[model samples]
Target: MTLYRQLIIFTVVLFLLLFTGTWYAKLANTRTFLTDQLESHVQDTATSLALSVSPHVAQKDLTTVEGMINALFDRGYYQRITYTDPRGEVLIDRTLPVKVEDVPQWFVKLVPLKTPEAEADVMAGWNQGGTILVKSHPGYAYETLWNEVISMTVWFAGCAVFMLAAVGIGLKLLLKPLAAVERQADALGRGEYELQDPLPRTREFKSVAEAMNRMTVKVKEMFGEQAARAEGLQERAYHDPLTGIGNRRYFETQVGADLGEGQGRGLLILARVHALEALNTERGLQAGDELLKRVALLLQEAVSGYGDAVLSRLTGGDFGIFLPHHSSAEAEIVATEIASELGRLARERLSLSDNIANLGVAAYEGSVTLSRLLSEADLALSAAQSKGANGWELRAVSGESALPMGQQQWKESLVKALEERRVTLDAQAVIANTKERGVRQLELFARIAQEDGTALDAALFLPIAERLKLVSAIDRMVIEEALRFDFRSIGVERIAVNISPTSLEDEAFRGWLHGYLKGLPAGAPHINFEFSEFAAVQHLEMIREFAAAVRACGHGIGLDHYGRSFSKLGYLKSLRPEYVKIDRAYTGELLSGENDSGFYVASLCSVAHSIDIAVVAEGVESEEQAAVLKELNLDAMQGYFFGRPRPLSSFTAA
Candidate 1:
């Protein structure tokens, strides 16, 4: 039971006990007083009557005495009256049969009032004529006692009601702090570190609040520490200590993973130092080591702005750079720049003869083996070596079509879509493992209306939009559309939208969003901004900064496609998103029982739960999948099992 209810019941029970005890005591006292008064009243009446009848007795007028008794008896003053002679013979006797009126039989039985009899001597001028006995009727006493009892009960009941109201309100106020403490405990369980805003003044509650606050602080710190440790361990395993970039093992895993996900076209650049062994032989190993380190630095610097690129030290004198979405031209430019930096390092500092680097850049299309990519890169390197001293070659695959729309065409199309407000939101529900009336959150997928009046799924155009540098604009438009939506009409508590990592880099977009949210009227539902883990990790600081600012404005921030990054889970503590949506790829693996995929998800959930972040499995298409995900302790899920994404307007009626 809740503490509040327990207290209320206790108070009520105690009040009832006190009221019952007091009422019983007063009832007993009133009955005793009434009974004593009856006895005294009868005695006084008998003595006075005896004296009045004595004159009649002295005149030997028995008829007069009998008349007086008859008069008193008819008035209902006495139950019985009798005059007996000194020889104990009954002279004049009067009795009335019992009659009960109005009062309930139960009341009469519960509070029985008995008649009291009194006796006195009647004198006939100095001699006793006979003894006079009188008894008071209990009917009047019962009526009087019942009325007094009712009045006292009514008064006490009124007082009890008033007292209960006053006490209930006072107790609620006093225990209000405990309510705060209870909420705090729930928040902690939810993985939120919400602090108690107003410290309770009550000493016991204050102590409990302080203790809970302390525990919360400690738990947050502990999760952070755990994340840091895990991040560190994972980084050491995958990262190159010398260059502070990814190592060979990490590089292959990332490239293979991305390829497995069907990244059709991307650039693979491999650079090798020229004659590293000869250099180390001629100019000490330290100088050679320094050159290698410098080259790694330059390669890393060159790939900086290309979001989600992998730079790794493949070997002692070889380094590799992989860009997921770069074109052939862009890859060449980055490689050429890296070549230039190496030339500078060797000529200006290392004092090495000839060009210091040989660059091989290969662009591939469609699904290809990792060995095929490496072979192409090697051929390009050989071709480069055949050229000038500071040489570079690009091996490009033709006949592989990229996005059908060009940059200008995409710009025109998206601009028209935005200007005409052609974009509409289609929503899919993310439901808890437990069934509920509403969803955990509504994932709003943006669709753009084409010239032909057909709507293009966001998946078809968002990449194009991102490439055109208009992703932020589209994102902003989506936000505006969602804001205009009546969430109440849609019957949803929260809605989430996917955010481009490129957009997070836009200061203007963040500013516009802040102002936009600020302009919303009070009690408007907040839009949940979600980012892909792939993009989020690329710009952690940006995500961290933007997340803080946006959440402060009464919105939620979450991770989309979580666990795809293959990075340490350490950043989760820092990002502290409200929840994470597991990528669909992972969800597909749940068909197998106790597999690596399931274990990975379980581990992910463990770390996520430690930080109080809810893990949701996406792409659940069957009951079996849902059941498996739920067994994995996934808090919620989004997939075809619930229903396909429908027009946002349809959600309201649903």
Candidate 2:
């Protein structure tokens, strides 16, 4: 039982004991007082009657003596009154049975009131005439005692009830601080730091609350320190000091990993500032640095609308940009935009040469070495430098042709595909690292089959769809397909589909998603919608609301590419997604020995698991990587090492 109930019960028992003791004492006192009153009443009446009857007895008035005795008996105060002659013969006699009225029989038996009899002589002048006897009635005594007992009991009962209620309320108020302490402890367990407010007055409780507050603050500081250390390590290793973007090392590691996997089509642009050494000789190094910073800012602004575009400082004057899943036709537009911005920078006197920069754009597809792409872009750069001031060029490597479709063609193709319902479902299993090697769940990717029988992954088409405001349509179609899947046949209880944060912004899409989830069959597999961490951070409110609505229908949400953005880890506490798939860029850094990536991954796992969130490492293509991840306390692993993406219909019971 709770302390409140225990205290109330203890109070009740104590009150009952006190009532029992006081009530018994009162009963004993009442019985003693009544017995004395009865004795005195009988003695006084007998003496007075003897005196009154003496005169009558002296005259031998038998009728008068009998009348006097009868008068006293009829009064009912006396139980009996009798008169006798001097020779011991009875002259007049009257008696009534000893009985009590208006009192319970149990009460009378429990407390027997004494009825005392007393006698006095009736004398004629100097001799005794006769002896008169009188006995008092106990009925009046019992009535008085019963009334006092009833009144005392009612008063005690009322007092007990009022005391209990007052005590209960007081206890609840005093214990309010304890409730706050409990909540604070729970929040701490979930990696949330909450302090108890309005310190308690009680000394012991106040001490406890202070200690808890101190501990909470200490733990929060520790978490912040760990997060900062990990982020600092990541920054020093991968980010450029000058521009606050990725350095050449980060670009090679990330872009190489993406192209090595042969995932899809993309473009790489290499821009070199012209005559930077000459400019630095004319001005100071500070001015050259200022000029470079402006160029970086202009490049970032020009491609700000594009998704997953990586810009980096390759060397002193050469910069690199990699756009994943971007078409060749858009490549020229991006190149010319950067070139036009550089020309404006020259006009603003940031550059001494009118030929401020030359951009060499190279398109790539499928698996290829990083060196080959760089070589191709370098040749194109040489061609641009020969052309004139602020010139640019676009080229593709010898055998492979770039994706020929432009923005308008992509819009037309995506719209038609959605209209024709030409989407196909592909799934890859996330396998647990436990001894059972069980499949955790399937991650679904939407693919559009082209007229030539070539399938286009969402990575290749989603950016275009989002740009054309057709992402919600694609998301809706993918969800409908996922729901129609036969999870029972594969013995899988859950599946996850990617969801664009943009889709959640559409009121109609949100309504349809909620309705569809609510109408699912009773035994349908639970659906988990995934949002990239970068996009999720941008639209947290929308995702939070959508998460709440879907969770009401037995669904949940997860974060994909988790560590790709520079968003704070604190949001994870509020978002509380079902799981987070660590970005492949981090996963690609895992090696057999100790490294910064291992420390970073371990830190991520610690932060996530403290809040009961599962951490998954995606893109685990080698046993060494998986073994390294397994030691990092990752909940699951996903990538080609387990299996490649295949048709959902091909899945069967494991």
Candidate 3:
């Protein structure tokens, strides 16, 4: 029971006990007072009557005495009246039965009123002639006693009601602080530190509330420190401090994990400044550093429009760019744009050669290893340098099954695919680390079929779709297919689908998705929309609004490729995703005997777990990596080790 209710019950019991004691005392006093009054009346009446009838008794006038007694008896105030001779013989006798009216029989029985009898002598010239006896009736006394009892009960009942109302409200107000403390504790358990404001007036409650507020502040500080540590480790390990982009190590690891698994199809561009050593010797290292920073800024701005672009500083005066799901046609546009931007920089007279830089672009279809792809890009760079200053060259795949198509052709293909509903979903199981090898959820990937009976992964086509502004249409089709899918056939109750952050910017798509989620049946699988960490941070507020809306309909959101971007970890608190899937680059480093990755993963887990968020590792290709991740307290894991992506129809009903 709640403390409020317990206090209320105790108050009522106390009132009842008090009322009972007071009620009995009042009843006893009233009964005694009525009995005394009855006795005094009987005695007075008998004495007065005997005095009046003494003359008659002494004169031997029995008729007068009897007449006088009858007159008094007729008044009905006396229960019995009698006149006796000196020899103890009764001369006259009168009696009436007692009857009470206008009072309850139970009251009368509960409180029996006593009748009083009195006797007096009849004197005749100083001689006792006869005795007169009178008895009082208890009907009037019983009626008076009953009325007092009724009045006292009503008075006590009225006071009880008034007191109960006042006490109930008072207790609620006084204990309100305790309720606030309880809520604060609950939020704290979920890694949210909330303080109780406007402390209670009660001394003990105020103290307790103050303590809770202090504790919350301490917890917030602890989590902030922990997040800062993780972000610092991430910076030292994967980021280029001078340019705020990825370091060469980060680029190699990320590219290998993303592209080496036969799942990545994209273009890689390498840009090298013509004479950084000469510029440094002539204008000092500071000027050369400033020029590099400017070049890095230019590249970042050029590729900002591509959602999946990756830029990194490979070495001194050498830069690399990776645009997944892009074709050689798109690569030419990007390379020309870069050369044009660098030309403008050269004309600025920052002690640079007129050539500025040369660019080499290599487009791959995921059939080549990372080393071979880099070698091809290096050869392309050499060719561009030989061509002339500010020249660029594109080295695309040679006679591949999936040829690189132009922008217009790619757009036409994607539009027709969506129109014909040729999109297929490939699901991979994300399993939880438990005794049962529990399946957490099936993450769905979208693939568009081609005329050659070959299906292209979304990574191969989504960039073009985004460029063509057909992303919203494609996402809508994917959501429709997933919702209509019979997930229960495989006994899975939850599924996660990747959603484009760009789709959230489209107001119509957002409204339609909200409505569709709300209208889903009760038995429908709970949906978790996922967004890449980089894109999610770019459009934080839009994603936050969409998440809130969907969550109201029993849906949630998650972050994919977590820790890939350098955005602050604090956003995790603001977004509060159901889970974060760590980027596969970090997972691949498990067997490399690198202490930084382990510490970074541990800190990330601590920060996320503190806020009650689940952590999942992606790209778990080996049992060794899974063993290392399980030690880091990862809630779940995904990759080829668990299961490869397969058609949804491949699973049989349990």
Candidate 4:
């Protein structure tokens, strides 16, 4: 339970106990006072009546005595009234009907009310004639006591409610500072070394806050000092100090890790500035260093979109990058981007020297080591130098292959593809097994069709589009097509469309998407937006904003290709995505012999299930794979064995 609730309950309970005891005491005192008042009132009434009736008693006038007694009875002051002569003989009597025996006789006897009896001597002319007597009614006294008890109870109940409310509010305020302290301590443990705002002026809280603030300041100062030292050492260990890019050691470490794990399939690019020593000798060392820095900056900016792609200055004038998880087309796009940026920088530096930067790129796949990747890239670089300066060559693993067009050619093709509306949609089905038959879901895929009506595979052209910085245009086209598609006719319960991370970063693109989605037909509830786990993790804040925008339009968000990178499961709980498509690699190995893929998949399913996220297995190619996934209780499955990628026109409504 929260501290606020616990504190409030404790305060209210304690107050109730104290209030109850006090209320009981007040009730007892009121009852006693009422009883005493009744006793005194009866005694006085009897004495006054006895004196008044004495003359009649001495005259032996029964009628006068009876009249006086009847007057007292008519007043209704007593439950029972009795009058007896001096000889103790009954003369007049009045009593109420008995109903179910009033308070138990034993209980009444234990704490009996003392009914005071009054006596007077009847006389004629101040002489005694006969004795008149009166006794108080116990029932009347009991009734008065009961009335007082009811009044006391009502007052106590009202006071208890008021006191409990007041105590609850006060306790909550008193514990507010303690709650703040706990939150601050939690933040500190999570490595957020900053103190929260100042606490209230409670003495104990103030002291603790001051101490925490001091400790945070000290820790931050120490970290800053240590970071400075580490930066200096890193410069010597892994960076080219003049160029501000990684040195040879950094290159080896990165390439080694990528090739060692076979983590992602991609190309490596190596480039060298020719005649650096000659330039330094003829001009000056300062000019040469400036040239290297310019080249390093150009390379860095070119591959900025490829998250985790590493660039380093291997040695004098040479730079390299391991493009993990990128295809041959992606590598070519990176090479062109770098080459263009370098060309611009070279032109600006031409006023100082007549040197032009040259570039080289290579693409490889299928279990390559670091040495082989580097060697291939270097071979391509050497080939580019041999052909001519200010040019680049792209080598493939099969042999050295040359790029036919320049950056302008690639850029024009991407622009034309968007303008011509050549993008087409492909979809894969997600099936859910229910008691009666099953449910079919579709995932949207983007394909580029050429002018000749031949559909170009996404694998061939997406890299080029991205390299030309036209991914946002392609993404927008995909969204437009998805919105326009009639999925209801095809019986697709849900249509998931992939949104690029690059497009999400563009505020203009986000605005355009929101406006477009707002105008979509009201009956279309099947459209769902998706973003890759790798992209979402890299630009978390941007993706989150996009997801919120999508959800506002009455659609849901999904994570595609989840588990591409190691991510905290906590994000799943916070983002609360509707579904996640497990990465194909994990699914492919799930049924491999002598492997524990079943356990791994089951664990992932369990975690996702815990947060109410539906998990779908991707790239399931066999019945065995599907059975294993079903055994794990996977929510859905998609692969070639079940159904190959096809156009939306291929399927009909069920």
Candidate 5:
């Protein structure tokens, strides 16, 4: 039983024992008092009656004596009254019936009242005439005892009921803190740390709560330290410590990831510090290092709003910024920003006499090798340097435009698509990492079909949709379409849908989503809502609230592109998502069999699985990679190696 229940029971039992003892004592005392009163009353009555009869007996007036006896017997107070002659013969006698009226036999038998009989001599002037006997009736005494018992029982019951209610409420309040403590423990078990608030006043409860809070703090610190260590390890592998940004290795992966067809174009801006070597020689290496950090900050600021932007220090004085989903004009904006910041830095700190900076912007359209792309950007940098310091140039390589249409045209097309529901929903199979299980779940990807019969993938239109603020509508459509899917006919039990991170922050969109989810068909797939790991980490608390709301409809939530941002993985330990998709960079390295990525995947899996989360490896392109991941105990995977994303109607496996 709960502490509250136990406390109430104990309280009631103690009250019962005390009340029983008290009632028994009162009943015994009352019974003794009543018996004494009855005995004294009978004795007094018999003596007084004998005194009155003495005059009659002395006169030997048999008629008067008989008349006085008859008058006394007429009163109902006596059960029996008798006058005996000197020879022990009865002169006058009166007695009550065997069974008295208005008194129960069982009650009398249970609490028998013995009315004592008394005898007094009826004396003549000098001789004893006869004896007068009187005994009191027990009916009145029985009635008094019965009424007393009824009153005592009713009062005891009322007090017991009131006491029980008061104690029950008191116990519940006292144990409320204990319930919170229990929840905190459960949260900890599930890889989450939930702290208790409003400490209890009770000493024992307060102590326990304090201990639990301390434990929560310690665990949070431990996870933070561990995450810091992991992130540090990651940085050492792919980041420049002094610049506090991505190193060359990381830039390479970003370039490769954005190289696929239909993946939006991006500009690689290469900025080199012109007088860094001279600054080190003239002042100190510290001054040169400070310059590099300033430039890094400027580069970081230039691409602040672009979620996919990456800044990295390739060498001591060379830095790179990759701005994805931007045109030459957009790239020029970044280049101009860099030029302005560098000019300010030179004017303020370099005495206006030092060489400032040089920037080269090279934009790519389709698949391109990192070496070739970087070389083109470098060539542009050299061309800009030919003019002098503080010069910038842009090199655009031609291919299909991620968005060939203008801003207005793009908006019109998207709005039309939304209104007409000109959208296609596709599912990519997330196969089990091992052969024991078949297909994991169907992950839905959306495409907005244009009038010309070309369906643009989200990568091609998402940025433009964001600019138009229409991404949420598209997301809603995708959700509706996924819910419309006939799960039974498709022979699938689950479907996974991706949500725009931006839309999650939209209040109206969320309200609509939850309200719409309630109307899903009975045979609809158990939907899984997915957010990028970057978004999940950024909005940890909000996502937790959203996840709870989504799960109310028997759906689940997860993170995709997990482990991409190099942010602390501590959120995973708290949010406790249903699954996590490890980005393809780590998976791609598995083919070589020499990367430390395998160890990273193992650690990631261990942490995720400890919280009952499954890990899915994205972009598994080879059997060897799959084998390595399976060995790492990966739960699932999705890529061309399994099956490429296709229209939902084309999906055959459950």
Candidate 6:
């Protein structure tokens, strides 16, 4: 029960006990007093009658005594009157039958009043003779007891009502402080850490209130300190402090997260100012920085919309944006607007002799990772820069007539590469450092050999393949070829295959992969599919579905270039991949003077380990970097210093 109800019940019970005891005591005392009064009246009447009838007895006047008895009855002071002779025989008796309506028979029987009888000895001139007996009636005594009980009941009921009202009011006043404490607790639950108001004068309540207020203040201070620290870290990680726009790191992180969620079609616009180095040389650093800031502002204003869009300064004169759910047409519109805004802002603010800004727009249909997007946008921006001042261009579609001949030729070559399965798998050996045991795991890399016997590096052809929407088909072909290679004969337990973001976006690719892997020979537990952090994050839902399908077929998922994003780490818990490869940018600088890189790498390792995610250090070229990574409890290492990329047949021969 609630406290209020319990208190009221307790008070009522206490009152009833006291009231019942008081009533019982008063009733007993009243009964005793009435009995004494009746006894006294009986004695006095009997003595007086005996004295008055002594002369009559001596004169032999029985009639006079009988007449006196009748007179007493006429007085109506009793229900019964009797006079007895000295010989123990009744001389006169007067008794009336009980009336039905006078009093209840049960009540009369329960509270029977015993009126005492008194006797007086009558003597004639000093001679002892017969006794004169007189008895008092019980009805008069019962009447007196009933009147006393009625008065006591009235007093008790009045006191009980007053006590109940007083107790109820007092309890409410006493619990008011507790109610305030409850309200404060509720507010705290809602993340409001304000202290409760002052409580009442009750000592217990005052102490409790003070303690609660102190706790609230301490918790608020702690959270404030944490928030401040988080904000400081965010500023260092995400913002270009000088320009007040997002930094390159922040831009990369945001794009990675957007791609991971597959929230919108990936569209990135990279804007760069041509001749920035020359401009700085000619106009000085101050003017150049000011111009860059103006450009950033212009870019920010251009992409402003209800949906998610971010503009960030990636470098000195380069700015980047990731627009959500934007189509190719929408991207072109935004690019035009940005180009116009940049021109206007330059003319208004820079006081430039000529317009110096160039904008490059690139839109991806499905999942596109930050690295791929950056490379494509950069390529487009370079094209614009080469064309001279104020010239802006959207990245050329592979088959579009606008593409240069070289790009068009490259697109045809990539298509030919796919049809002929000219793509060859190159394996880089990732060897664990040990004197007694040297086991190598191959990291699968793709190389495209043309029909003319000219091999193309992924650095050149992969971006073109992605631009032409041919990456997924190329990635699928690579996986199929890797599975065909007998890695067991090469003394390798596992091989890693790189999967592009576009590959994950292809729903049919996952089904084909599942069907192919299901036919793999039993006990072949060595094939692992690797995805870059940017690519994996771009198509997280698809990646998850693909990962599940792969694992079902005895393969596992590994995240490459991990920690390249600034999004929530919660997805890592859900993905729960076999391993996370630390980004090369971080691992490559492990031996350098940059302590923050090591710390960041270590923090990622810690977080991943907490969720049972094994950490691998990518680009660990030096023994020193490898040692440091090992000290951080990294699970694996890969770099050119350990092994270089070679053809699959060469790997098998080794």
Decoy 1 TM-score against native: 0.67
Estimate TM-scores for all models.
Answer: 0.67, 0.80, 0.87, 0.58, 0.74, 0.56
lDDT ranking, high to low:
3, 2, 5, 1, 6, 4
Clashes of each: 0, 0, 0, 1, 0, 6
In model 4, the Cα lDDT at residue 114 comes to: 57
Model 3, range 129-184, lDDT digits (tens) per residue? Answer: 98999999788788788888889999999999999999999998888888999999
RMSD of each: 7.5, 5.0, 3.8, 9.8, 5.8, 15.9
Residue 158 in model 2: lDDT:
93
Across 524-626, the per-residue lDDT of candidate 2 in tens digits comes to 9988899988777877888888888999999899999887765678788788899999988788887734388788888888778877899999898988888
Cα lDDT for residue 541, model 5? 87
Per-residue CA lDDT of candidate 1, range 461-575, in tens?
7766887788898998898888787887656778898889788779898788889888889867867889888677877898889888888888878998776555667677678
**Which scores higher on TM-score, 1 or 4?**
1
Candidate 5 segments whose C-alpha is farther than 4 A from its true place: 35-137, 154-217, 257-264, 268-294, 315-320, 336-409, 428-443, 452-454, 486-496, 501-530, 533-559, 566-581, 587-654
Which residues of candidate 4, in runs, are more than 4 Å off? 1-7, 79-87, 96-116, 119-131, 138-176, 182-196, 211-242, 248-269, 275-291, 301-310, 321-358, 361-380, 383-461, 464-499, 503-541, 547-654
Model 2 is weakest, by summed lDDT over 10 consecutive residues, at 397-406
Per-residue error (Å), model 2, residue 236: 1.2
Top lDDT hit = 3
How far does residue 68 in candidate 4 sit from its true spot (Å)?
2.2
Query: Per-model C-alpha lDDT, please?
Result: 0.79, 0.85, 0.87, 0.69, 0.81, 0.71
Which pairs, if any, clash in model 4?
Answer: 122-129
Which numbered prediction scores highest in TM-score against the true structure?
3
Name the candidate, 1 or 2, with the larger TM-score value: 2
- Considering TM-score, which of the candidate structures 3 and 4 is the better prediction for this target? 3
Residue 633 of model 6, lDDT score: 74
Instruction: Give the alpha carbon lDDT tens digit for every residue of 1-654 in model 5.
Output: 777777878898899999999988988888899999999999998999899989989988878887887787777777899999899999888887545556667877878777888999999989999999998887788888878877998999999999898888877777789889999989877877788788888899899999999998887676666566556657777778898888887777666766643456668889888867878889888888888888888788888777777788988788888877766768877788778777777777752344578988888765556677688899999999987658898887655443463577878888999999998998888888777747788898899888989788887678788877898998988988877667677667888888877888789999999988888777777888898887787778899999999889888898887777877777787677889998876677677664666777777776677667899999888787788888999899888888788898776544
Candidate 5 achieves a global lDDT of: 0.81
